[model samples]
Target chain A: MKNTDKSAATARPAPGSCSPGPFSNAKGPDHRGQAFTRPGSGQCMKRNSILDAAARTFCRDGFTGTSIDLIAAEAGVSRQTIYNHYRDKEMLFGAVVDEIIGRMNAVLYGILATFPEKPDNLEADLVLFATRLGKNCMCNQDGEFLRKLIQAEGERYPELFAIWRENGPARVWSAIAARLARLAHCGALDIDDPDLAARQFMALINTDLQFCGMLGEKPTEKQIEDGARNGVRTFLRAFASRGNPSTKADPAVKPNMALF
Target chain B: MKNTDKSAATARPAPGSCSPGPFSNAKGPDHRGQAFTRPGSGQCMKRNSILDAAARTFCRDGFTGTSIDLIAAEAGVSRQTIYNHYRDKEMLFGAVVDEIIGRMNAVLYGILATFPEKPDNLEADLVLFATRLGKNCMCNQDGEFLRKLIQAEGERYPELFAIWRENGPARVWSAIAARLARLAHCGALDIDDPDLAARQFMALINTDLQFCGMLGEKPTEKQIEDGARNGVRTFLRAFASRGNPSTKADPAVKPNMALF
Candidate 1:
C-alpha cells in the first residue's frame, strides 16, 4: 500500500479475528501475524514529526533557503520516507502551513467559545476574553510561525497564502463579529457594525503587542493581561450602549475593577 | 576620494572659485580640473541606487540567499563598487534598512503633521488624516519592503532590528501620541493615555487593511478611504470629548461630512 493512503482506512481489526470484541482492536499481535491496532498510526506520527520539523526550519531559514534534505535530517526521517509522504518541497510546505492553520483554528474556536454570552460585567468579561485570545491565539507558537512564514513567503506563494487569508483572518473575523452582533442585539453594545468593531477590538489588543510580537519576543503574562484590559476598555468606551446604565456612569473606572 | 565618504561632506563650492556665487556650486567644470557642483549629489545618487537595488533583492531573495555580486549586478555597478559603498553584505543590509526606515519616517511625520489639530469637523478631518496615513505611510513601497524585511530577519539580527524598534514604531507612536495629547489638552479628545490612544488609533485603521497589506496586496484608494472613515468614526466614538457637542448628538451621522 502507498504510505500516504494507508492512513485513510478506519482503525479495524485484522480480518477473521477475535469476534470483534472491544479488545480485538487492541494493539498487539493478532492471529494472522499482523498487528491489530490503529491503522497508519506510524505513518501519521511520521507525517506529524516531519511537519513539526519543517515548520521550525521554515520559520527560521525561510522557504527559499530551506531544503527537503534539511527537513528530513531535522525530522530524523530518511529522504525516501519524506518523499513517500509528500510529493515535493512545495507540497511539504503547503502541508506545514495547513497543519499550523488547522491547529490554530482549533485554539481560536476554543477561545471564541469563552466569549461572554451573558456578561455580568462587560469590560471585565471582555478583558478575560481578549487575554485568552491574545495568549492562546495570537502569541502562541503556531500563530507566530504562520505569521512569519506568510510575511516571508506570502509574495512568493500567493495562492497558498490566499487559502490562509480565507481560513485564518476571514473566518476569525466572522466568528468574532457574530459574537459582537449578539452582544449588540442584547442591548449591551451600541455597535453600528459588528464586523468593524470585531476588527477594531483585535487591533486594540494588538497595538502595544505588535512590535514585541514582530520581533518574536514572548510577552509576559502581565503584558498580555494589561493589553487586553486596556484594549477592551477602549472598545467598551466606544461601543457601550447608552442604555447600559452600569457602564454609563464612568467608563474609565469600569475596567479596573479587580479583574486581574 | 572614496565614493562613499565623498557624500559625507556638506554640499559646498570649490575653494578659490569665481566670486563664490550661487552658480559657483552649479554643475560645471571649475578650478582644480574638477567638477564643482552640489557636493554630495553624485555620491547620494549612487548610494540611493545601491540601497534601492539592495532592498529589492534582499526582500526577494532574503539575507542569506543574497550576495554582493548579485546586488551589484542588479544595481548595474561592480562588486568593488558595492564594497566601496558598504563594508560588506551585512553593512549593506543595514544601510538598506536604514534608508527605507528613514524614508518611511519622513512620510510618517508628514502624515502626522496633518493630524486634526483644529478640526472644524472632527470625523471628516480624521478620515482625511487616516486616509493619508494609510495611503502614504503603511501602503507605500518603502513601508511594505521594510515590514517584510523586519518580519523575515528581525530574529536573525536582533540588534539591527532593535534600532528599527527604537526609531520605527517607537518614534512613530511618540509622535502620534504628542498630537493626540495636544488634541486632548484642547478639549478635542477625552484621552487619559495618549500613548495607548495613538496605538489604538493605528490598530483601528489597520483593522480591515491588515490582511490585504500582509498578503502584499495593494489596497485601492477607495478601500483606503473607507477603512480610514470607518476607523476614525470608531476612534472618535471612543475618545471624543464629552463637551464636543457636534459629535455628541448622533455619532453615526457625524462622520459622513463632505471632506472627501
Candidate 2:
C-alpha cells in the first residue's frame, strides 16, 4: 500500500519525506526529480490532502465503519504516514472533526461579515445575504461533510460534539445575533430578541434546503435563491421597524417600494 | 440475552411487558400456564413488542450496524418469531419506518385539527398551537426515531426516504399551508405564500430544540414552550393582517392587551 517511490525513500531528506518538520525548507526531490516549491509547504499539502480524504471517507462510511487504511488509500499515502500525523483512528477522527468545524466556522463568519451592516434596501440586501450564506455555508462541501458527520456520529462522541456546538452553532448564532442587534439599533428592525431572531433567520433560510438535504439531495441554485428571497421577505415583514414606513407597511401592497 | 421470563420482565407489564394481544387481557401467565389472560392476543402483543424494539435499536445503532438478532434480543423474541413477521432485516426496518410514519402522521393530523379556525386572539392561539405541535409531534419518541432513521439511512435507501418525504414533510406542510391560507382569506393574516409560512412556522418552533437534539440532548418542557411561544410571536408578526386592528400594532408595546 506504500506509494512512496523506493528511490525517493532511499534519498529522503534528513527530516523524512512525510514528517512535518519545522526546518524542512525545500521539499526534497521526488523519485521523478520533481522539486516542491517549499520545504514545509509539501508536508502541509500532504496533511491537508489526508484531512480531505478522511472527511470524505468518514462522511460516506461513518465513524465506526471507516478504517484508517481506507483513508490512507484515498489520500494516496501510506498507513504509516497517516499514523505519523495522527496517533490512531480516534485521534484522526478528532482532527477531522476539528478541521471541518474550523473551516465551517471561518466560512460562516465570512458570510456573516457581509450581512448588510448598512443596507440600502433591507429586503434585497437580506436576500443577497441569505443567498450567499446558502451557497457559501450550507451548500458547500465543508457544510455537507460537517452535517453528515454531526448526524452520523454526534451521539457516539458527545464530547467532540460539545466542542463543535461551542465553536460552531453557538459562536455563529452569537455573531449573527450581534449583527441583528446592530440592525435593530439602527432603527431598521424592531427585533426584541436578537438571538432568537438570528436562530429564526437561519431556520427560515434553511427551510427548503433542510428538507432536500435530509433526502441527501443538494439543492439547486434556484431553490436556494427562492428560499432566501421568501425567507427574507417574511423576516423583513416580521422585524422591520414601524418607523421605516417603506417596510412597515405590508410589502405585498406596494411590492416595488425600496426600503433603503 | 433472553430476559423475557425473569421476575423483572413479568413485573414489567405495566410499562415494559411486551404483550399487546387484545385477548391476552389478563397478561397473567405464559405458555407454562402462568395464566396469560386470553388467546390470539399473543400474536398482536409480540408484533407490537418487535416493532418497539426495532425502532429503539434502529435509532440507536443505525441501519448498517443493526441486526435482526439485536432486535430479537431487545424484543425478547426468538429469531424465528421475528422472521415470522418480518421477512428480513430490511423488511423489519421498512415496517418500523412505516409504523413510525403512520403514528406520527396521525398525531400531526390530530394536532392540525386543533388549529384555531377563527382565533379571537391570534398570537395566543398560535402559541398554544405551536406548543402542542412541539410536544406531541417533535419531542415524542416516534418523531425522534423517524428523524434519526432518516438522517442515518436516507441516503442508502433513497426510495424509502422519498416516500417519507412525500408522506411526511410534504403532506404536513400542505396541511399547515391550507390552514394558513384559510386564515389569510379571513383577513387575519397577510400571507402571500401559505406554503412558505408553514415551513417557516415549523422551522422557528424547532430552532432551539433542533440544536439540543443535534447534541443528543432532549429539550425540556420549558424549552419547548419557550420555542413555541417565541416562534408564534414572530410568525404572527410576519403574517398578521394590517386590517386586524388587534394585531396591527406591535404586541410588545401593549403586552397586556387581550385581542381575544
Candidate 3:
C-alpha cells in the first residue's frame, strides 16, 4: 500500500522528461543541483525507500526466493541504483534487518519515553509496550517474512541470526532488564537477576499468547490481552518489593552475630 | 566417522555376500516366530533406513542441496526403492521429519522413564534430564544434525515446524505441566496455571541455557549447565505454589491489564 502511493507519484514523467530512467533526468549537468539539492536528506530518504521495498519483497518471496530484479521493480529504481546503495544480496538482507530493528526500536523507545512516574501508570505503559511488540512480532506479513529470513539462512549465515539477536530481541530485553534492575535497586521492585527476570516475564507473555498462534492457530485479541495482563501481574507479584519486608526475613541475611 | 566405518564395511564386494543392499546373505526369509513380527515390520524397517539416510544427507547438504541419489546411496538401497517409499521430495522430507520426531520422543521418554517416583526425586531427575536434553538440543553431532534439519526446512515446509512443536516441545511441555499440576494439587507445590508455568519453565531453559549456543555461539559445558541451573531455579521461584497465592494481595497486579 505504501509502495503503490509512492510509485504512483514517482511514476510521473517529469515536465520535460526525455527518458523514464530515474537517473536519466537527474544526470545532465543542468539538472545536477535540482537532482540533489539536499543531498544528505535525499540519500537517507532513498535508503529508507529501498529498505521498505526490500522488506515487502523479502517478506513475500523470502531470501532465496527473492531476486534483486524484484526488489528494484518494487522500489521503482534501476538495478544499478540498488547496487549503488547495497553491495550484494546478503548485504541487502542485512540492511533490511537493520531497518526493521531501527523501526522496532523507535516504536518501543517511543512507548518507553511515555512511561508514567506512578507504578500503576508504569505497569500500564509496559503492558502497552509489550502489546505493540507482540503485534509486530506476530503480524502475518512481517512475522512470516522474519520466520523465513531467520529459519532459512540461520545455519548458512549464522551471523545474521546473531545480528538479529543483538539488534532486535536482545536490545529490548536489555533495556527492560536494566529498568527492572533499577527498580529493584530503588526498592520499587525485588529481583535477584534482572536479565533472568526479564526473560521469564517475556516467557509468560509468549506461552499462552503468540507461539501457538504463530504455528497456525488464531487466538482472539481478548485472549492475547488477558494473557499478557495475567503474565505481568504474576511477574510483578514474584518480584515487586512493595510487600512488608518485616513479614518474611531474607533467608541469606539470618543472624549476622559478628556484625551485631 | 560412523559414515566412514559403514562405507568401509560396504566397500568390500564378495561373491557369496550381497553388496550393500537391504538384505545380506546371513539373514534369509524368516521361517520361525512370524506371529510375533509386525505385519509391516519389513517395510517399516526399509522406510526407516531411507529416512535415516535422508536425515544425514539433509543435515550435510540442506534440503535444496541434497539429492535423491545421495540419499539412496547412503541408505544402501536403489533410487527406485526410495521413490517407491516416498512419492516425492517433499514427502521424503516429511518422512525425515517424522523419523527425527520419532527418535527424539524415544530418547526423551526413555530418559523420563528412568525416574518414575514423584515429588522429591523430580528436581534431581530434572537436572539430569536437562543435562541430557541440553546435550540433545545444543551439543555434538545429533544436535547439529537436528539444527540443520530444522533450519533447512522450517520455511519451505513450515508444517514441519508444526510437527516439531507438536511432537517434540508441546508434548513434553504438557506432560511437565500435568506433573507440576498434580504436585500442586497434592499440596507439595504452588501454581495457578500449570500450562503457563510449563511454558515459562521451558522458555527459561531454552533462552538462558541452550538457545544462544544453539544459534552458533560457542558456550562451554560448564556455562550451559550453569545457565540451565539458574534458569530452572528462577522458573521454580516464579511459579512454585508456596507461601504466596495468586490473590489480590499481589501489589504488582494492575487494574488495567494490557494484552500483547
DockQ of each: 0.44, 0.42, 0.16
Instruction: Give lDDT per model, in order.
Output: 0.69, 0.69, 0.55
**lDDT by residue (tens digit), candidate 2, A129-178:** 99998997788777777777776778778777677667776676778889
DockQ of 3: 0.16
Give all candidate RMSDs, comma-separated.
Answer: 10.3, 9.4, 14.5
lDDT string, candidate 1, B39-81, tens digits: 5556544455556667778987789768887766666566776
**Which consecutive 10 residues in model 2 chain A have the weakest lDDT in total?**
A251-260
Compose the digit string of candidate 3's lDDT tens values, residues A1-260.
35445434443222122211121123322312233233454554455545656776665455666788877766656676666667677777876765554445555566555433345444555566566656655443444455556644556666656765565566656777777787677676777767767766776565555445433454555555655665565565467665634123222111211111
Among incorrect, acceptable, medium and high, the docking class of model 1 is acceptable
Better of 2 and 3 by DockQ: 2
Cα lDDT tens digits for candidate 1, A1-260: 55556422312213212221121123322222133223555655555556667777898889877888877766666777777766677877876776666667767778888888874687788889998988887877677787888888877788877766777777777788898999899888988767777878888887667856654567777778888877888888888987575364333333332321
Query: Which residues of candidate 3, in runs, are more than 4 Å off?
Result: A1-62, A67-88, A111-125, A137-148, A158-163, A217-223, A242-260, B1-62, B65-88, B112-117, B137-165, B210-215, B218-220, B243-260
For model 1, the stretches where C-alpha displacement exceeds 4 angstroms are: A1-46, A77-81, A214-216, A245-260, B1-47, B65-87, B214-216, B246-260
Q: lDDT tens digits, residues B1-260, model 3?
A: 35545434433223113222221121322323222223454754555456666776676567766789877766656777676756677777765665556556666677555422455644445556665666655454445565555544555677666766566656666777787788678765667667666666666555554335433454556555655565555555555556433211312212111110
Best by TM-score: 2
TM-scores for candidates 1 onward, in order: 0.76, 0.77, 0.63
lDDT (0-100) at residue B119 of candidate 3? Answer: 58
Candidate 1 chain A vs. true chain A: TM-score? 0.75
Query: TM-scores for chain A, candidates in order?
Result: 0.75, 0.74, 0.59
Clashes of 1: 0
Ranking by TM-score: 2, 1, 3
Model 1: DockQ vs. true structure: 0.44
Report the poorest 10 consecutive residues by lDDT, candidate 1 chain A. A15-24
